[model samples]
Target: MQMMMAGARTRTTTTMMTTTTTTMMMLRRVWIPVLILMMFGITGGEERTWNTEPAYETQGVNVTVIEGKSAILPCSVHDPTSADNKPVKVVWTDQWSTILTFQDNTIIDDERIHVDHAFAREWNLRINRVKYGDQGIYTCQVNTEPVISYTVHLTVVVAPRLSNDGTGGMLEVMEGSKAELVCNATGIPAPTITWFRKTADMGERRESEFCTGTSIVRRYSSFSQRIGEAGQVLVIHNVTRFCGGIYECVAENGVPPSVRREIQVKVKFMPKISLPSKRISTQKFY
Candidate 1:
């Protein structure tokens, strides 16, 4: 009985030793990597350094400005890692080439182009004296890990302007012939041309007239008549003496300050002679 009890005690001691050895090996396996990471200055209590990339806070926008005026394109970014005091690189480009670039107090040398950075996150591009050619898509880019960009569409408005060459002047036509009067205009949105005719006394009259051969319809008002055809050319078929008058052409668009031009049409015909006493003329010859 004493021998059996001693053998049971020895087995219990062996079991405890094996359990301790297995525990120790498992702890070493778990702590080895942690110790190596600590040696390289990595710790769970430290603040994380990796951050998400910079992103645009606002979507792309459309900007409209009148010609010869200043235009502003807006761009804003939200950078999570900006607090680390790292340099942020910004670039502005168009369809053709790079307009400007900025990084660490560096900027493009352009008098007409300006970068407004009054707000830390806002980067607004300003262009002075914008022309028609400046109207297009402008892109703002940030130099990030993969790079991010925002696009802005610019529209330039131009007022209507009438051309003088072959557009307006004295137009002469023979009686019973066709006459064409042209009014040329140039503008950004393609100005609409309208023709008007003024009467002799400039009095108010209500009448509706229509012409053949291209079909010009005119609605007469008190002072002037609005030609039915809304085109650059005014067509008059079978022109007579009544067709000779002062015609005005107006070019207008949504833009302000419309333009107008006046043209005088002269219809020429042979003079007709009238004799009251046709029989008396024959007795005088005898």
Candidate 2:
């Protein structure tokens, strides 16, 4: 009986030892996996949030202008080829002018301005004879996922410019009778003509600059004639005393403000007069 009891006790002790060893083995496996997971987490570092501000490829453009001269508002752009998933929308605006809109190729025209060509994605705006009032902040808005904008400030400088052809008369005219004033100009974009005359009050008056004579100053005949392949001729016919004055011929090339040329007209006649009135006074008395 004593031996059987001692055998039972021994088996119970062995069973308890086995159970403890199994629990310790299971804990060792769990610890290895937990340590690996913690190490990976430590090396991974923290995640960063996305930036909310809009991305810009470049800064604004710079524009220069001459007062009393025409200019083109220029804006530089970069093609975002990668982010081309969305179409680009460009909007240009000036403080004193209405909003100008542009897309891939088409341009919109309004009463204030006109687009020379739209389809080529040329967003250049032509400002006729830049005045001080025309200078302002021009903004270029490009739309994609986030909107990108560029601002260009136009600086206008006051400078003398030729606004018209110096010639008031046609290319040819009668010799002794009368010759009209004639003038012409060449420039970029194009220019307008305003005749000026020396007045008693002001050295030059824009309104009365054309005529102070008996000869009729007909309507200004304007026609555009093609010169060479790249040249052009502008003609105005039937010039007279009224057509004579400080003629302002302005030429603008879209970049540099308008340029001008000043011309003086002087009519010459024969030394001899054929009329009988001068000799008749001597002969008629008889």
Candidate 3:
């Protein structure tokens, strides 16, 4: 009876140890999946936060200016909260290189270019004495996580100018011959050339007045009639004495200050003489 009791106690002890080991294995199987799921949830949340994009408002613009004038390129940040407690950095660039930069309350040094930070949200660039060479594309960039930028196009306009070579000079044509007059001009928007002819009466009066060097000129004395032609060249078909006078060429565009050039045209013909006695008879060796 004593041996049987001891054997029963040893079996009970082994059964208890086996039950504890089985419970530990089951707990590990359940907790391992739960821990992996928790880790995955934490990593996904972090990725979504990092992938979010900042919200800011900006727009591209077109700027126009006349030559020898000032130009302004505008840029503004509508929502400063997008920076998220970080200082904002701004940079201006052209096709060639960087023009200006603003960071930490400091701006890069440049001649004829500066930031007009009159307002807290404004970062406008001002250019003094703009020239034809300054016309092109300019970019305004902000250093954000993904970077944001705005583009501006600059257009420079110039007034019409007449060329000097063979533009205004005296032109003589024979009777019943064709005559051609040319006027050359250049400008930013391209120039439109118009031809005008002074009337015979006006031409004669202007000539007389000019010869006398008179200051006071008669009204309508310099008036001219349009030739109903537009181009760099004006052609006269079968020219005659009526076509002889002063011609004016006017070049104009949208820009200010139109230009003009004057040309003088003279017509020549054969002279005729009549004799009283069938060609005057001359005495030979009288």
Which of the numbered candidates is closest to the native, going by highest TM-score? 1
- The best candidate by lDDT is 1
As a TM-score, model 3 comes out at 0.63
Q: List model 3 lDDT by residue over 67-154, tens digit each.
A: 9899998888665434245445566777664445443232334477777878767778788899899899988766554456788899
lDDT of each: 0.73, 0.47, 0.70
> What RMSD does each model have against the real structure?
23.1, 28.6, 24.1
The TM-score between candidate 2 and the true structure equals 0.31
Model 3 Cα RMSD, Å?
Answer: 24.1
Error of 3 at 45 (Å): 23
Model 3 gets an lDDT of 0.70
Clashing residue pairs found in predicted model 3: none
Q: In model 3, where do residues sit more than 4 Å from their true spots?
A: 1-58, 80-86, 103-110, 200-222, 272-286
Candidate 1's TM-score: 0.66
lDDT of candidate 2 over 5-101, digit per residue (tens): 9999999999999999999988866664445334323224463222332244445666776666666665444553224233344556666433554
Per-residue C-alpha lDDT of model 1 across residues 133-195, encoded as one tens digit per residue: 989998887755445779999999999988776634799999899998988899989999988
